[model samples]
Structure formats: C-alpha cells, structure tokens
Target: MAHTKASNTPSPRTIIPTPVNSTADFAAQQRNMSADNASQGSGVKLKKEIGLLDGVAIIVGVIVGAGIFVSPKGVLLYSGSIGQSLIVWILCGILSMVGALCYAELGTMIPKSGGDYAYINVAFGPLPAFLYLWVALLVIIPTGNAITALTFAQYLLQPFWPSCDAPVEAVQLLAAALTSLLTVINCYNVRWVTRVTDVFTGTKIFALLVIVAVGIWYLCAGHTDHWNEPMRGTFTAPGLIALAFYNGLFSYAGWNYLNFVTEELKDPYRNLPRAICISMPVVTLIYVITNVAYFTVLTPEEILSSDAVAVTFGDKMLGFMSWLMPFFVACSTFGSLNGSIFASSRLFFVGARNGHLPAAISLINVHCLTPVPSLIFLCVITLILLFIKDVYTLINYVSYVEALFTTLSVSGLLWLRHTQPKTERPIRVSLALPIIFLITCLFLVISSVFQSPIEVGIGTAIIISGIPVYYLTIHRPVEWLRNLSQSFNLWCSKFFICMPNQEKFD
Candidate 1:
C-alpha cells in the first residue's frame, strides 16, 4: 500500500487481532487476545466496542422487536388455547437457548463474524456456506429488518389514525425512510449503533415492564376468567403445534445474533457465552410474563382479532395513556432493525472477505471506518422488500427457512466434533443438548411443510435457486459475471473512498 506525502493525512487505522485459530486451546487464545487488546491504533479491522452488555443489548433488542409487539397473537391463534400458547412460548425459549448454546461453542471454536456462514464454511465447505449466505441475503436477515421497520411504522402511525388502520402507503413510506436512516447511522460508526441499541433496549424493556406490571395488578384484582379454562381450546395436531412454535420462535429469532459479530465483540471467549447466558433467559422471562400480562386484559378473541397486540393491550389497559405503547413499540423495533442491519452487514463483509461474496462488499470506508457498501446494499434490498404488497408476506416462510438453516448449522457443530475432536472449545455445550435442539429444529422444518406447503415450497425454491448462483459466481465463474463483478467492485471502491479489508494506510 502506498500513500501521498501529505502532512495532513491521519495515521492508518489499526486492525484488531484476528480471532485465534479454531484449533488453539482456549487458555492460549485468551492470552493472545489480551496482549492484542493492549495495543491499539494498529489494524484495518472493525473496532471492539461491543462489550458484554452491548452483546446482551444487541441480542435482546433484535429478538424483542416487532414479532413480540405486533403479531404474538399468531402464537395464540395457532396454539388454540392460552395454556398451549404459553407452553409453546416457554418451549421456544428453551429451544433457542439450546441452539444458542451450540452456537456459543461454534462462536468460540470458530470465532468468526458470520455466525452460521463461518461455521458451515469451516465444517461443511464453501458451497453450502454460500447457499446459506445466498438465502440469508435474500430471505432471512433483511426480511426480518423489513418486518421490524413496517411494524415500527404501523405503531408510530397508529396513534394518528385512532379510528382506523394506518394507510399502507404511509406505513411503508415511513418504514423505508427509517431503514435508510439506520443504514446511514450504521455506516457512520459502530459505537453510535451500539449506543442506539443500549438506549432503546432500556426503553423497550420499560415498556414491557409496565405492561407486565399492569397485567399482574389485573390478575391480583381477580381477573382470572380468561384462564378459567386455560386448556379448553388447545390444539392436538402435530402440525398446528409446530406452527405455534414458529410464531413463538420468530420473536426468539435473534438469540444467536451475538454470534454474528464475534470479531467485533470485546472478548469472544468470555463475553460471547456470558452475553448469551445473560440475555436469553432474561428475554424468555420477559416474553412469557409479558404474554401472561396481555392475557390479563385481552381475551382470546380480542387477541386473535387485533392487528397490533401491544397497542390493543395498551388501549384496553392504559386508557388515556395508550399512546405510550405505540411510542415504545416504535422505539423497540427501531433498535431491532438497527441491530439486524449491523450484524448482517458484517456477515456479508466477512463473506466477501472470505471470497464467497463480491469483493466490493469487503471494502472498508476510509472515512467512516465501516463497511459502507454492504450497509448501502442491504438498505437498498430492504427498501425494495419494504415496498412489496405485504412487506412481511414472506414472514409466512421466513421462520421456516430460518429453522432449516439453523438446523444445518448445528449439524455442522456435530460434524466438527467428530472430525476434529482435538480442537479446544472455549465454552463447550453438552453433546446431548445439540442433539436435542437438532432433533427439534428438524421437526420444525419438516412439520412446516405440512403446515403451509405452498409457502415452504417457495422457500425451498429460493434455496435451490442459490445452487446455480454458487456455480456461476463462485464454484466455477463464467467470464462475463466475473468481469462484471470486478468492474462493479472497482466502481464501488472508488465512489465510496474505500480500501480492501487487508489494506492499511501508509
């Protein structure tokens, strides 16, 4: 790398130490990282600003977004009874914890930023990894962000149209605007993003706390009629139970989000598992109790009929102060969208760095010290997805597809264990835990086809579509596509004032 002889130039930003090699023992890796942390201002890598608290906040913020606030009614709707819905919620939390535990081992063992992509790439190989990335880039992460933004818009606008649903156009327009704004904020600085996450996580928790308190008061005041026959309408079909879990698990989706930025996290060995340990159970408790609170005021029929469950809960319970529910929901979802965007951009950035994605995606903004191109690319896709007739039309299939990939990821952990038994795990989970979670996730994916065949069919089609893309762009690239990727990569680099990840200032 060369630089002009200009006195005004700032020193080249230092990249932090790369994650320890997966084969190294945990004790040695920790010492290496501590030594690396002692030296600052050296590398071109992302800054390590996400401490343990930040990790917990990111996971909670992302998981507690729109799914909980807007459509948790789906859980009750599919489960067919209060008792069953509550059971599914608890089971979903356990399942997420189990899966997140498996990921902790992967995060510490592999210690890379792309979560499933990194693990699968190491254990399975690049082709399957690319497919996961392809589907995620298309179906999972951005779709989740779009749903969060849409819900944020709906709640923020609901206060304005007290008598009717907010106009779809207004909701979507605001959703796009919010998405764009967050993408810009994310590009500017990592700390700025984490600060927004921490602040909003607090407000969001307070909102849920109020709901739970009010509901508890209602329960204490002898409003037990809704639970008089809690098991009265429980569904017995396996498929229906699986659908209920899907609804419950969507809110639990980001439990593994912290694994996505293992490199950016302050101390992956200590903080990764610690954050998971702290965040998952707390979120599960909040979600389950919060649902219990909702039932205290809203009957089964009301929950099934209402579009915005939290807002409706507010209207029924908060009276004149109902506006606060929508306000806080907007805050919760805005944070969720920011967390998802921050994590997923790093996924693509790492993927590009590893040669699975376009090189331009790996470029770092010289001025912003962030992956500007990936953030912008994600924002553009999210905006396009946001404008579709129903931004969350794919929500029907999104969780199903997510379950499929996570299953694949955990299976990779099992594979790594058998293949490389000597590798030291920083936070080893019980072998039986991954086996149980694996079986459960497999059941969810299989049962989803029976629950909604057409939607699952579309998701399967999307996954299959990636096979050819892998061939054309990666496994064996053709002349034209490779050239196009090169030309586009150069244009992006120049226009963004960016340099490749491995390059540093002189």
Candidate 2:
C-alpha cells in the first residue's frame, strides 16, 4: 500500500479516435448551439404587436384635437388673414414632417419605447434624459391633458346649458370627472382604449370633412363673399411666414406620438416610418382644405373675432347642426387625452425599468398588463390642473418646454449618426434633412422663448430643479453631490445653463 501511494497524480496520455466521426459530431454540436442562440435572441426581440393602422390611428387621435378646434381663432388673430394663416399651417406641417422623419430614423435605430427620453438618453446620456422625463411628467403631459379636458367640458356644457347659471366649480368638477373616467377606460385594457380612440378619431375626421364639404358647397352657391377677399398679410414675407409657421406647429404637435410606442408597435422599422410619413401629409391636406373652406365662407376679420371658430363656420353653413361642433370637439379632446395617457405612461414605465425613475412607476399590473399606478398618478395631477381657469397660460408654459425638448430630441439624431454608425437604422434621413430639422427647431425654440420669456424662465427653473431631486432619489449623499456637480458642468456646456464657462446651480 505504501508503494502504490507513490503517485497520486496520473501521467498524460493521448487516445486515437475516428477522425470522420468526431468531425461530424463536432459540426452537429456547433449547428445546434447556433440554432439555440438564434432562438434566444428572437425571444428577447419580441415586443407588443401593433400594426401600421394602429400607429396611424394613434397619431391622428392625438394630433387632431383642441388645437384645430381652438387655435384657428388665435392664429386668425395673429395673422389677420385666413389665407396667410393657412400658409402658416402648411409651413408648420412641412417642418413637422422633417422632424418626424428624423425621429423615424432614431426610432427605428433604437427600436425601444419611451419616445424622446429614449432618444435623448442614447445620444446624451442619463441626466438630460431624466430631465425631459421629469418635465414631461410634471408639466407637459399633465397640463396638456388638463387643458384638453377643461376645453372638452367647457364646450360640451356650453351647448347643453347655454342659459343655465352653473358655478365655476361645477364646470371644473365636470372636467375632472370626464378626465378621470377616460383615464379609467385607458388604464384597463389597451385594446379597448385603442378601439375607443379609433372611433373618436374617425368621427372627428368625418366631421371635419363634412364641414369642409359644406363650406365649399356654400361658396359655390355664391352664398359667401369672403373667398376673394385679400389675405390678411403679405405672402412669403417674414412676419407672415413666422405667424403661419407658429399655427402650423401647433397642429403638428402629435405627429411624433407614434414614436412613443415603438416597443408596442409591431414591425416598428416598417410601420413607424410609414405611419409618420403618411399621417403628416394627410393632416396637412386636411388643415389646408379646412382653412380654405373657412375662408370661402367667412372673412378674415370674422374668423379673427369669433370666439368659437369652428361653430361660427358651421353656423354659417349648417345652422342648427352647429351645436354638434362642441360635441365633436369633446370627442376629439377625449381621444387626444386617451392617446397621451397611453403614450406618456410608457415613458415613466421605461424610465423606471431602466433605473432612472422609482421602482413604483415601473410596476406593471400583472392582471391588466398596464401601468396602472402611473396612469392613476397622472390622472390625479391632471385633475388638479383642470382647475386652472385659463388654458392659454398652461399652453404658453408647457409648449415652450415641449418645443425645447423636441428640439433637443431631434438634434440627438446627429449625435447617434456619429456614435452608433453601424447600429441598425431601418429608416434613414437624407443628408440635408437633419440640418433643415435642426434649423427649424432652433427657430421654433427661439420664437417660443421670445414669445413667452417669463413662462419659459419658469419652465427652465422647474426643469433644473429636477436635478437635485434626481440625485436625492437615485444616489448616495457624496455621490449625489459629485453627480450634481458633473451634471451642472455638463448642462452648462451643452445646454447653455446660466454662463458660458462657469456652471452655476441656479
């Protein structure tokens, strides 16, 4: 036994094998491994299935809302010419199309959800991404829904109770109730929400078509004299073009909403690009034709002075049926709110899933497969904002921020082009398109800032305040301070925070 314990380790040895058999077995094993990896990758790539029609429906549902219903009066007031205002709409549509195209490339490249937040993060990193998400949750989405809800309640109540002396509180409560109800519907089932939205979107489009058809018919009958009246402002002039562009920009607000649901959209690479390209031109045509109809029936002065622009146009041609205008407006607003609720909640969900937001927001309702917590949180905030008497103030404040963020998001396309050159981009922008998009966005941002310097300043303050909160929530004390310092410097250099060289917290 002692002698046998001499070697605990064994000597190396080689054994011969059938070379052909071993080679065949090795090749078979490799093929099996490759097949397994492919299957696993496909599983990871799976996403919610939505088609091009759904994408188009979502875009139209969100875009054709209170803007068209309420903004015509404001644009008429600004431009003082129906024809010139229509031109503005056209210009905005074109600019929006350019932006949408840029986003399409980004959306296809990333093919993730979360809309602007995703694009911004991929290009600039997390801080700027979180800032946009913070602003969107606190300001843009809530305020927008509140404004629409209030408008919806106002018009719906106005027609039914024209002579009823209701308290302001009653109207506010009604608006909040309507907003809450729609929120519930949307939070329950995606399919149900989409179906409701489709109906509302279709109705709104049909109503607009009817108005245009009737107005044109009346003009052909020589019932109106405003068709040949000179435009309110000179064509192609800077002032006129600027005014028109603003109007068009308002109409183009939701053109990029489809990008928000990239994960839910089936075949996003094909559907998203097609949906945006198709929807913008169609909406532009609708706006131009509708404005032409309006001008054919009423003078620029009349449109400018009218409190309810669509109703006035309807009244001139449709008489008693004009009351339907408010109802249609309500439907349009409801659809818009639903679309926003659906898209914006996904922003929070994605942010949370990626650790940018709290875990609570990312919690999915297993039963409904919807982000119920986020949806309910948004509803509460919107309900509170519904009490604000004036919609214009909210728009003035939120629109500026939205335009700024949108500009930043579009500018991200340039960064991605350099950083992720080999990344899969199912959609591609032309060489000059990004340049044109950037220029247009800059103009819009400048115009918005000049138009509402005070509101823009307030918005800036609100957005910047998020940095501290973000640190508090996500980082340890010392790390938080360091991150804040770094973020301040980064934002100063990139976003023109307070000074050109020195980064200040304020």
TM-score of each: 0.91, 0.82
- Where is model 1 poorest over a 10-residue stretch in terms of lDDT? 14-23
Error of 1 at 415 (Å): 0.5
Clashing pairs in 1: 14-42, 14-43, 15-42, 15-43, 15-44, 15-45
Instruction: Choose the strongest candidate by TM-score.
Output: 1
Total clashing pairs for each candidate = 6, 3
Candidate 2 segments whose C-alpha is farther than 4 A from its true place: 1-47, 164-166, 235-244, 389-392, 475-506
The residue-by-residue lDDT of candidate 1 on 1-506, one tens digit each, is 34456754334452322333232332253345334434543535577889999999999988888778877898999899999899999999999988888999999999888999999899899988998999889878788788888888988898789888999899999999999999999999998999999999998999999999999999999999998898898899999889888889888988888888888899899999899889999999999999999887899999999988888999888989989988998999998999999998989988998888888898887666789999998999899898888656776766687888899999999999999999999888999999999999989999988889999998888989999988988889998887778777766755776656543311
lDDT of 2 by residue, 1-506 (tens): 02235764221111111122332453353345335435544211213656787788899889998888667766666666666676677777888888889889989888777889999988898889989988988778888888777777777787757676446777789888888888788667778778877888898898789878987787788866664555736455444455456666776688888877788888788889899988889988888788778778777777777766787777777778878887888888888888888887778767865667644455444335566656776788888788766655766666667878888988889877887788777788895988888887777667656665787788899899989977776554366554554443333222211111010111
CA-only RMSD, every prediction? 7.0, 14.3
